[model samples]
Target: MTAGIDLGHPQAQAIQSDEDVVRVRQLVRTVAVAARLSLVDQTKLVTAASELARNTLVYGGGGVAEVTTVDNGRRRGIRIVFADDGPGIVDLDLALTDGYTTGGGLGLGLSGARRLVDEFDIVTGSGQGTRITVIKWSR
Candidate 1:
């Protein structure tokens, strides 16, 4: 496990299939527990990770997820970055809105994941794929 104080190197896992998504969830849970996050916080982070991982596999056309432990002196947190080289999202706004999905899903993956984390960021363009980063801080 990487120390929270070290922000230079993060652990990464490839998200290529359903099994990969499960592995991502386990990795996130491990890191979250190691960070001494509350059970509720851990669950939130895990749920968010699972959603993002599935999105990476289903929509992003497979990618990698980087997990890192973070510390801001007084607080500790877990950060995850999901990146994939899919077709990319054409409408960011529409994608983020509730009840919107191109794959006939519940449309809660992106927006719901965002709500579960303390920080969220997304980068994507036409044919450029997508990258999403999220963080959960321990309370």
Candidate 2:
């Protein structure tokens, strides 16, 4: 959703296992740091990345993520994209509602991640797969 220019090449990784989720968190943290995000902001972005990566692996049946740095001219930011080709969410409204869980977890993955980021965008459908993009700007 950012019209901003890419600051560097995206660092991509497959989201196929629990370990990959951890790696996502680390990569996001690295970018957040490089963007000069505050410590709190860094934690929020990394947490969001963890949840989204987990969702990509579980609900999406594995996928890929790209973590990149972006600059909207005024400030630097960290952008993360999570995509999957599994069964797409049928009810996006319900999926985003807090406490709604289709995977038996706490149901905080999607909604919580949205709250943690400065910008959130998701493209999904019943059989169209899912692509989620989140960005957190450095203040």
Best by TM-score: 2
Candidate 1: which stretches are off by over 4 Å?
A: 1-8
- Which pairs of residues have clashing backbones in candidate 1? none
Candidate 2: lDDT of 42? 96
Candidate 2 lDDT, tens digit per residue, 1-139?
7668898799999998999999988888887888899999999999999999999999999999998899999988888889999999999999999999988999999999999999999999999999999999989
- Give Cα distance to truth, residue 137, candidate 1, Å: 0.6
| Position 50, candidate 1: lDDT | 98
Query: In model 2, where do residues sit more than 4 Å from their true spots?
Result: none
Q: Give the true-structure RMSD of model 2.
A: 0.7
TM-score on alpha carbons, each prediction: 0.94, 0.98
Q: Best-fitting candidate, measured by lDDT?
A: 2
**How many residue-pair clashes does candidate 2 contain?**
0
What's the number of clashes in each of the models?
0, 0
- Residues 50-121 of candidate 1 have per-residue lDDT tens digits of 999999999988999999989877788998999999998899999999899999899999999999999999
